[model samples]
Target: MTKTIPNYLRIHRGIDRQDSTNREQSQNLITSFWNSYSDATGWRIDSRASRKNNVLELLPAVTSETPQDHSDEFTPVVGRIAATRLATAASNLTEQVLRTRECLRQREAELASSAAMIGVEHDGKVSADQIEQSLADAMEACKCDAAALYMLDEDTRYLKARSVVGLPIERLENPPRELRGSRGDLEAMVQDVVTIDNMTAGSIDTWNSPEPFAAGICVAIKVDDIPIGTLWLFRETTTEFGSTESAIARLVATNLSLLLRQAPQAEIFDNPQPHQAIQEIAQWQYESLPVGSALAEGWRVDGMIESSESWATGWHHWDVLPDGTLMLAIAEATDPTATGAMHAAVARAALAAHSGYRHTPAQLIQRVSDTLWQTNTGEQLVSMTYAHLDPETGDGIVSSAGSISALISSRYGYRPLISSLSAPLNTSMDSNAANHEFHMLEGETLLAYSKGFATAGADQMTLGGHIRTAMQLEDRSPLAMLRRKLIDLPLTQERGALTLLRT
Candidate 1:
């Protein structure tokens, strides 16, 4: 296919032109043609293109007064010779582009290698200083005389110079903030890569540079496409950056972004206070839930929970009455951020007191709610789902304190076991308690879960509806398979207890 590639729109333009020698050769050939037919032709090479059809045309820049004067004599031999030069020029420019791309790919692979090496170590691997050192090494590899690394503060939009070589601190401290009141050039952070040769004052803020400004490249350090900071490299001579230089800068920015992103983990690990606190809370959060096994005559019940850094859930102890009623409750604190172990413990005690054979699922939750009101359970509220099942008859009853609805799967169909939403635990006893009853066919399953389970691990409606449609009548794997799938989901950070009863 032919690209227009006018003389002005040629690939060999500015810094992108790689084959200066070939371009000069092509220009000489055109001049030679004008000299050969100088007196015979008013022909000049006016419009020109490095053609894609394996050919080149040196038209006579004149009226058709002498239309057939020179065509017969020179057209055949000149066309062949011109084709050779055209191919050479095109091939050279094409090679330049390919070379730039290959270099960038190699740089990316090198960055990945650096990341893998750092990933092997824990505490010292992702520190901010490590990032600065890595970036400095990258600067050396990129062959820049001077470079600086800037990282955004935890709460501030402006960037601060973290590390630098061959640059003054006063001028390089802040690049740009992409804000109105900020002092630096906003384009430095907003654009992909900005390069300027012979930079002056006010334009790029190179006015304060120690040596006379020459050339510079700036790129934003981005994570998941959002700019976090800027990386700058400067040269001492008047030379514009090419694609290869810009690409290397981008790759360096990417590596810096990843390192900065992981820096928080390093900080947490190096500081013993937050480290110990995280370990303790993580232990309490996971160990607080009973996920092993809950089995009785004609019932097989099991559950699991996974929490993010921000939220955790505690499940009430399972109840297996003498009548083979398998009861399970999953609870989440009203304030999603609070990891309220003591509050969950109090609610579990109340639930255990009434979860025996005498009380129905609705009645048991009602009693727990009343206890929360009367006792010193504080102003805390909890959302919970309590479900009890008689696996022998495939019969079950479910009650919720504004918890997620249960999912029922069988040969008939698979979907969320729809139920009415109700008040949470610690509500007034007078508030109505809603109950949902469900029956399962042979080899069917009933899965009850907390609010976190509904959304975190997967889309609530989509997962439930998929289970409903794909459920097998004789499947034995209850919630275990579902739990594993949930754990693999990116959004499953706050996934809570999931209890399943199989008939």
Candidate 2:
């Protein structure tokens, strides 16, 4: 093939000549012929090589003459050479395309397998132990003295330590740092990677780690373009991290992000024995149900709980205050074990205890937040909706935190009521809760539910449509109907909801 290329080029260069006036036109004509040939053959020849002293450049220039007039003594040789070059180019282009496709297929297969294995290992739930193990592995990979992973809370306002190795958890989470300020973690997240040569320079907030030494590297853990958390590697000596260390840290952070994205509801506490765990889970489930429905003048209130898991952390409550105000609450903890149930219980108790204070919905949420902080349970992820309603006028104010869903449905239609963004309860010391004021018209109802409702194949929009369809019927017990519909769906987690109807 190499010998033929040179011979072909030499023979083609000897037979082509045209006037300078027609030279440019001849070159364009030659280029057009090759381009047409390439299109017909579906081969992408290099344009630069084609323009150079190649076989295609030696074609006889076309003029105002017959086809036979352009044919020369070298016609047979030129035809043979062009055929050979086209055949070789086509083979090489096909081989290159196949190789590129194979590489892409291999990469896709690897990613798919990784995702499948992750799903199988965690079973859609990442535990505290798993995160801690990941931190330890990352520390070992980076050859660091300690490692830690800090994830944003529900509000994305503070970075809380999700897992730690070679450092006290309390020291890392004593006071969670804000996500907006000029800190090492924030810088790493914004800049992709950051290194700190001095730990006490105030640029990197170490939370005053005990026995902390000199240097550290912070790598942002993100899923796609969204920043989820930061991975930190600490060294005892003041040494800068090399490219290899930084790269390994990035890989570890990427894997951790996959786990985090897959399992947003992480178990943050130690797992008990299977038997003890089952028993505690059962106890939590039993205690999560509301005592009964609330009754007031011209008001109807009811709630339901459904779960297929061994434990569910959803609860509902309603109480009538001395001033004829109806207090309603629905909450679910993100933890999937007994710990989550305990957190939900704490939130429920806080709401019940403060119902008599005649506080507005926002004020009541703040008080509950304060209670959670005082009880040392403010760090847990809990979504809740608390409301205060006047039974006489059906006027109400509701506040939601985290992902709790709420809407108002009537004969007309249904629309979401909680649009304000707020972090889940206990996520922050200062709860920046927003209050949504609404008036429940006659024959209208308020529905508040947990994450399981959406996870069970029904989103707020779908549920609204369903409610609209159900309202067309003359059924007095719409809540029961909706509960039955939800029960029929495949269960993935705990589902809890409460409905307040003004008749």
Candidate 3:
């Protein structure tokens, strides 16, 4: 079929005639003719692509303009050409729109799946093996070829690859160094852009991808403001990532970071365990007490013994020896700063108690003194007090260093026990050690505590006064007296420790 040229090109050629001094008049006439023809034939003229050379080929051989002999030939050819071109244009537009819609649908499905995997339901991995399986499922669902999960190292400065799919797990187990440079050739190789598929890499900017990895996205795994590691997806195509896909990847990373952070703290000694360990630790002290008679009948061990360097808990203890002649023992409970200091004291105590050397309390007290140091706010240390009651004897020894008051009393009445007021041990190691020794006369009570006791919440909760009054009302048995006071006092809510001794 002979195809007629578009009418706009014919008008353009006709208007450009060199003889026309009236260029505007000629162009207007040609435009008017084409417009009238287009209206009658339902054809539209596009002037943008008009050219003089193509004018004859573009003009429509419409019925009204046909010559008598050639009309049959030209008209049918022009009509057929118009029909074919329109069908081709329409088909091309439909195909382009369909492809665009499909891309959107694929991205939406990927996002929904990612959200479901890491959604409110917390169980992603049931076992160590399942972690890899979960990550693999995410990668597969996302249509990424390679994926990796890295953990923030203990120092938190960098991320180390822990689990991966499409890479050897053995190599990912640990990167030589999480830092980019120190990660060496294999890691550094991956960091450089190896494919055109990712936004993180481009013609102007490059980032590493895995070996044999052509393209994909790399998203940082983060929780709160902390960046734990990275999640990487790799593929063969030059995959241009969309905003929604990037967000879904980041969400997966956050879920992974949260799970890893809590795993260790939950399993460690930081939490409560069976009483077996506590019982074993206190076995020696338990054996030293009287067997037949109730050592302190009804004097319940209120809670599990807690270890500390602070003198607040008198039940917890450590042995001390410095320069052989100084043998000392400390018993206390945990404070906010107790964990580290208690461990230090435990090491010192264990060595002293086990060392085959003569021990004098004087030498030990001298070595165990305190030292001054600036606080976080640059303030001086607070006052602290120390007192010792020999487990073997009911005798009490006391020392005070800008500390709370000490109380000594028999069943009938109470009196303040005095010790030479001196600087705390660590404040000045060479300072004179103050020592007060007195036998806990049978049926008498002795108490020493931190300032928390006096500052306790309620008037009736004053630890010192309560213990004194309880002693004054002491039952025939020492155990009954302690049990009565323990159950009756309001000291639990306020922060303080009370160590009671009776002969």
Candidate 4:
């Protein structure tokens, strides 16, 4: 017997008619449906039948006393209701997409504003501590609680906590080793660590003692195949950290990883690249502060700017604040708008967790700044992502702007960092997209890079595919693995640097 749900309840609860009835007697059908498909949840359907007349209306009928108002057109009340519901859902989706896009714009504006502080002259120099404070201000702008930074030792044997925000400055000044051995008591060992909802007990104890954090995520920062370091995040109880929060953290990490290599200073507003001496470039770094501005209520930030001449043709740069948060910025070889649009699309994709997309210079420019890239017709999006990593716990974020294949390379192979695609900056959006994350172990290395590198080849698997393969083949150390896969891979001819850190 095929059981079904009662028509009235099903209609009221938003169940489709197909599952609400069957050939069997109405009661028997419902009973059998429940018995057979109890595990199934309700589904959606479209119908125009009047609830009162169709024997399924859960609410009172509209008063019929009112005379017919419109003569040219007539829409059934049920149809109107359905249309309204659909409109509401669509409106909600649009609002969400716009909100996410607005977030990107705001982040960019913050970076631009900070860049101005560094001056176009490139005469500014910010210290690591100042960078941490700036990052804290930026994180405050984003409503984050606490942020930290971890840098890989030159030997690549261990990752150390270098800076922190929203926590005790003393702790930030002298952060405890983030990684711990299994069976270690995290509660007793960790000073200001907070727990995150996503971590599982088994997974938390997989590597390092007690795990560095009680529940927060630690994003991996990589250049090429080496694990450079990470940014760590935490918040008090009551707020459940979601995928966006984690992604933002990872974005900060990537930025810092790149910046630390160039300017390991404490003050940021004091450097100028004179004449043609190595066309000076500026990178941004950040830390989330405890206090936030009213306009950016609940947010704080600290950032760094550095001068680098590497990849003058393509985009490449990252920065780290004193506390360990990271900031990453890159320029592509494509049109500006396409680059922005591509990044926007990538952000949406990361939010959605769909299969990756490969970008051309044209696509990248279109994605980042729809009007600017279109009007100026410049090639390159100049995108950025801020994130972090924690050696104590193999957890972190990996957000990007037109960047692809940030991954963890293990002895087994390289694993791509996956994220869900939200709504594209302007194109169609997908709210059902699932946000994805990558987990790492002690022997692993974080691999991060700009999109220019991935799309540089012409093999035609799409740049994303080439990078994906490299990440999956996490054999040997990250640098070694990167050299083997990227050096011989028939990717595009463009050049870009890879950042890495290993435990």
TM-score per candidate = 0.46, 0.44, 0.33, 0.25
167-197 per-residue lDDT for model 1 (tens digits): 5333332353423443222466677677765
In candidate 2, stretches whose alpha carbon ends up further than 4 angstroms from where it belongs are 1-288, 291-294, 419-421
RMSD of 2: 23.4
Error of 1 at 221 (Å): 29
Order the candidate numbers by TM-score, best to worst: 1, 2, 3, 4
Q: Could you tell me which 10 consecutive residues in candidate 3 have the lowest summed lDDT?
A: 298-307
**Evaluation by TM-score, superior candidate among 2 and 4:** 2
The best candidate in terms of lDDT = 2
Better of 1 and 2 by TM-score: 1
What would the C-alpha RMSD of candidate 1 be, to one decimal place? 16.9
Best model number under TM-score: 1
Ordered by lDDT, highest first, the candidates read 2, 1, 3, 4
Task: Assess the local accuracy of residue 362 in candidate 3 as a C-alpha lDDT between 0 and 100.
Answer: 45
lDDT by residue (tens digit), candidate 4, 211-239 = 23334545555555344455555433223
Against the unseen true structure, what C-alpha lDDT does each candidate score?
0.58, 0.67, 0.43, 0.39
Candidate 3 yields a Cα-based lDDT of 0.43
